[model samples]
Target: MIRTGTEYRDSIRDGREVYVNGEKVRDVATHPMFKPLVDIRARIHDMAHDPATRDVMTVTQNGQTNAIGNALPYTQADWWAKRRATDTVLDAVGGIVTRVGDETVGEMWSLLDGAEALAAIDPQFAPNIKAHIAKVLQADPFHVSANTDPKGDRSKAPQDQDPDMLLHVVKETDAGIIVRGAKYETAAAYANQAFTKPTIANWGDAALSDYAVGFICDLGAPGLKFICRTGFATRAQAEDYPLSNRFDEVDTLVIFDNVLIPWENVLFYRHTQAAMHIRATLHRYSAFAFVQRSLKLADMLIGAALFNVRQTGLDKLQPVQEKLAQLAVWRESLNAHLTAAIVLGERSPAGLMMPNQSLLYAGRVLACGQLHEMMHIARDLCGGQISLTPDAASFRHPDTAPWLEKYYTINDEWGAEDRRKLLAFARDLLNSDYAGHRLSFQMFAQSPPFAHLSAVYRNFDWDGPLSLVKDAAGLSDRVLGAKTLTPGDSSLSKWFATETPKGKAAK
Candidate 1:
């Protein structure tokens, strides 16, 4: 069901403990720091009911309307619809804001796709996943993910160090299990729930352990505290830091002090195999949305840089054009990867469509690993003026206004105010603290760079290359006997053989 903005805002006003900048937030929907994003999220909910955007933001299912983002993607069309819905939201907000439900809801879908693994552990777990997926569609609550725990002392196990270092079960009661630990989650303060699970770590060879647990955490539950990092919106004027003021998604360190997860909310518990399975395929469906953010970010980089160069008539220069082309290459490279991954989508173990893992992960590596360099290039193209520009207040000040206008005005086409606005925008997009945080988010939000490489390694068709080399080197079958290079060995390798294009040019 689709909820209005007011309903969405009211839902999170559950008197949950939330703090920012060392001060307790009385109302997250009214707080100066969180209100902007909360309003945006509420607007996203209202979009499903508004006459203008209702069509794009929602879908008809069982003769009832539901948020498109919550719908499970069963066909390629569903994925395309989800992608378009996300882009529409970004366009409406005029900037990128991750962790706003659509990006995180797919985490549950990944769990849904792992029903068999969950079933192997406990029969109840698979049904719980299906119920949660349906709950998301029916209730349309704001959802987020919880993966990275504040793991202390990596060298030592949880038993050696503080047992609470990693989120583990302290005790199991008749109602549910009480877990103690902390998780670094984005939007946890305002979000309704989080799909809490294990991070990227060694679970060890164990059949059952308290540390290996997964559940749906209600953010408003008792014994939970949201200690968020200071927001960028309240740090400066909106005119100076446009992206930060409106698009900053404040992350939080959610402290779970013996929080209880009712039995129904527990997706999997006391099952190391389930935890390992979840860690392995956690981002199968979610990475598509995560990488899509980078695509929009790439466009923002190109847009800000191109407009700056063009405003100064520098676009005509061959060198400037070369730099512009480089930005386009990065943008389109991301575009190609996303597009091709969808076109070559694969069916999940549970019969759900998943973006091609090899292309999606390789694209993630390219988009994230090279983002800082791209930002640097954009900053260079914008010139030193971005850093030297004065704030909006200085432009409007009575005494300094005239001198600022005289210097900032480039030509009749580019007036002082326009130039100032553009410079401020470029500054925030490329040089501000928010810009750096965004770059880091892209690098490590999903996982680290090394993890991205690992996903690519696990999914990529190594045997195809191996078989080609062995055949070219005239190796005997005995030498190549121990490997699986056949087409039907795996679903992805099968797609690599049939769906993916061939020939040297294809490479």
Candidate 2:
């Protein structure tokens, strides 16, 4: 059955151990920093129950239609459907919320079904992992995949630094293995049912052997501690801060202290290559999906930017129009790349049809570079007004209202109070700390920009374009060197007009 927002909230009421700023949070659902985010998440869940969005947001399984939450396609057609569904979902929620939250983590768990299928290749671990996945599916459980280990020194390998810095198998027994170390920057682990695959592959040879371990453990499992980080959303109040209210689902560093992983829950162990393969494949698919999300976000930002310009009466200025046009170009370019990726989707060896990796990677790289420029344009166009806008309370104050109304109102058509509210909404878009966090998240979500660009340059089929150029230049064997090549071999050059040669007749 599709769960309502309230039902989702009630389900998580059980106290989970969440530590923030050296203090433990008794209830995340009630925490000011977490509540607005949770409320927004609940709204997403509710969308699945709404008649309009129910079909797009949910799928039938085990004789019931469960909220799709974040589960996407395993085939090319499925990928297209998933992208369409994702657009619907993001549009419904307003793009203020990033796709990397509880719902996203849960959807990642569903993708683990594919991982378990691969693990099944090893007869020993296959059945157990499959069973583990079955259990999770049956319960409609939430999971956060923790792969980023704490690299104490960026240059040092996991084994070179402290083995404990990376989550590794501390002991093995017939029942299972015990793991220790920390997983850094995991999103919403406190609210998840389990943390899957801590410490990504490539920790070290010794580190890799122990670190290749993968498993699912309860969030409240013994010795597990969630060390929360303060985000922009966490430090603000919802009534006064709408942006944080909708987007502030805090991410945390998860510390594992000798956490036990049952043998049945292990998908990979001591197989670093296999582990890396699993991770690489997952990144390929997941990153592709995230590009779709970034495109949707760009669309939202474009609309908001245009609205801001219109509100400020700069819509007709050629320079402002040029800025908006640039933003539109970035938005369209991203969408075009994403669309191409979807159209060229292919089937993975695992039978999952993922988007075209090259195009998707290009979309991601473009998103990183373009978003920064877009934000800069947004800030520049909005001017000092974004930062200096008076608080909502000031307009209501008897003493401040007169002066604020006289000077702050833009045009005669809009009142001082109305203008202030509009500015507040614009400030919500431009000046909020949530916007900064979102920018950083988008920047690092796929991979570093240079690495992404290298992947795109290496993977795209440049040979196709080069062949066209070769044919145009009469370099093809079909041309047979019948004529000497000139700088204007195909098209006429203004400086080198084709005149009848002294000895040869013009064709």
Candidate 3:
């Protein structure tokens, strides 16, 4: 049965062990910090039921319907079609939910599909993954994927890091394998059903035997503890903090205290090279989806920024118009890369059609830098109004009405109340913790701009261009090796050394 939003909520009502700040969260469904995020997740669930969105948000699985999301089967083009529908749902939500932090986990699951691709190499692994996917599809389960191992020193390998820093297999038994240590910055673990696949990013020869290990376990599984950080969301009231209220997706550090993963749930153990391959491939997929989402977000922000300019009567200002033009360029760049990726997508071995890695990586690099520029332009266009605007309560206050009406009212066309609401909406974006989080998110969304650029440079086909350049330079094997000078280069070099003029002659 396809779970509705209410059903998804009720499913979490059962007491599950989750710790936040040294205290166990008695109920995630009711917790103030978690509830709003759950509300967002519920909305996603509700989308599956909505007549308008249902077709796009749910998919039929083995004799059952599952919420179409990052986890939808993509083992074929038909699967890709379903995923495109899922993309439609995500785009409808805008950055309101999925582009938020926890949505990172959803994107991770899309990449996890690659693991299923790897399972095809071994029949034993294939069946285990298929079963897990089927079980999760039936319940519409949420999973948090941990890919980064906490290394005390950046230069050191996972094995060199305090074993407690990286999750490692400590004991193997007939029943399961015991893993200990912690994975850092795990988003949405508090509200998720399970955390799957803690794999090492980089490995060495000594680390080869323990290279990559992938498995799944429930959030309440014996030894897992969640340590959450206090953020803008956890500290503010819903009315006073609209941004935090709507979008405080919490990130946590999940410590596995000898957590046991049943043998059946173990997808890969000690296959280090395959593990790195999976991580890199997942990065490509997640980055592609993330860029797609970010472009949509940029579009929304651009609209809001333009609206702010028009609302404030600054639309005619040349400087403001120039800024808007720049924003349009940024938006176009983002969309172009996304469209390129889509058109150039290829079928993965796992049957999932994935975006071109080079384009996706390039898009992420552009987004990281361009988002900051766009935000700055938005702030500039809004001027001091974004920071100086009063809160929502001030508008409702009785005594301030006369003064607000006289001063805040800009054009006679827009009344005081209209102006106040516009300012409030703008403040909700500019002054809220959401703004701070967005800045942080954009800054660190990918590994790094340079890192992404490096990946793109590595993956791009430089050989084709190199061949063209070499041939143009008359350095190709056909000419250079045969000691023959190409006419173009030889003539150009000779002409450069000796300039001839009709009037000046030989001089």
Candidate 4:
């Protein structure tokens, strides 16, 4: 079921209408704006078959192999494998690229978690979700999510404003439903399909609404247009903006113009409760992969800052070391949250393993909430030189080459060329337009800052802390109008079973 790199490339060449920077792209796999990310995605598929990486990139069950990222997580070890596979891909790519398959395939698993509720509301549509979940594993298509969570002008409803502002079911047919509206997606131009769904909105107790619809949208289907923001790849020399050229995941405003979602692909329709259920828990598993990117970003910060200080001998300064320590602290804080979430994992409503919700959400908050400040610290440690440095062309020019070489070369180990490349990298990672875009992307990629805080509020085990304080203060249960809360969190009870071998921790 696993696809080859070439197969992945051929799949996206299917005559999908794609435009970027006012030009219609004929081949996304080769277009300058998209080729880098497309090639990186292809490398991920190829890694699944490459002997050295296959063990980490794929899993086998019932004598069939599937991508590790596509397998449904059932145990802590499975999560570890998924984490490892994602890290392997990031390491291979040398820069962060969000919206690749691993980070998004989990959105389908969230639907699986809501299957019971979805079935209760609409029995006819529940089976479609389970089938698509299975299809993800067997077919191994590069999947992504489609939802900007567009908060339209609060004063006007969809009906008052443009009805097409929010993607809605225009009409249903014997074959399928035709959808109209648009979504901001990062990789729709090259991705195989998207788990299309409703953005966040007030359902207002409606039993049936046109806006309550979700589907498996074929990206190559008719009447779809991908209009992307201008890319950073060809704007400058790669040597001067390595990360930009190699890692820009082109975001697109995907216009779904009467696109058909075959009857079989419609996961839910005209069911507000089902839509609300999905909106509540959309990022349950996907957030782990999303936050993992911040962990890698932290690593990049530490490496870039540490190297910059070291090459300049500024590492000797106690003040400089403290700044580095702060970066390390933030980095390890992210690592600790991610690690603990896996070890303290919980079971989903569907009996699938979920990373400990509290720790995962908390990690997401920490990662996205303060990434800007961390980037600033890195920017400071990298020094003004990152911004003031001469371009690669200036360094290569005969007229200015001698001056840059004399000024940039620090030691025998740090040559003029190496110094120039390092400064360019630090600049791209911390100061370029792409840098700011990535910062904003992470902050709002999963949801807005308020949404991240809302998730933390919902997932944190408040009862455990409340019970601890109540016992300490000798408070009466009657005052709270509820039964006495237990000290142990019900979610973690299984993770913390009392029964165990001598001197061993419960799992």
Best by TM-score: 4
Q: Across residues 1-507, which tens digit of lDDT does each residue of candidate 2 receive?
A: 445677767766666667886677887777766776677667767777778877776777557665454444554444555666677866766654553342244334333545655554455766664465455444544445565776677577666777887788889988788888987544453354554564444455552477676676667666777788875664654444566666665777888888877786776777676565555444556665566677766665666667667776889999998988888888898888877665555455445455666777778888887787888887777677768877777777999888888887767777776666555655666667777777887776554566667667766665445445666876864443443333334211311364433311111
Task: Provide the lDDT at 339 for model 1.
Answer: 84
If scored against the real structure, what TM-score would every candidate get? Answer: 0.95, 0.82, 0.83, 0.97
What do the candidate models score in CA lDDT, each in turn? 0.88, 0.64, 0.63, 0.89
Q: Alpha carbon lDDT of residue 418, candidate 2?
A: 62
lDDT of 1 by residue, 88-163 (tens): 9999989998889988888888888888768877997677888888888899999999989888989876677888
Candidate maximizing lDDT = 4
Off by over 4 Å in 1: 482-507
How far residue 90's Cα lies from its native spot in candidate 3, in Å, is 5.3
Q: Which stretches of candidate 4 lie over 4 Å from their true place?
A: 149-152, 488-507
The 10-residue segment of model 3 with minimum total lDDT is 498-507
| lDDT value, residue 79 of candidate 1 | 80
Clashing pairs in 1: none
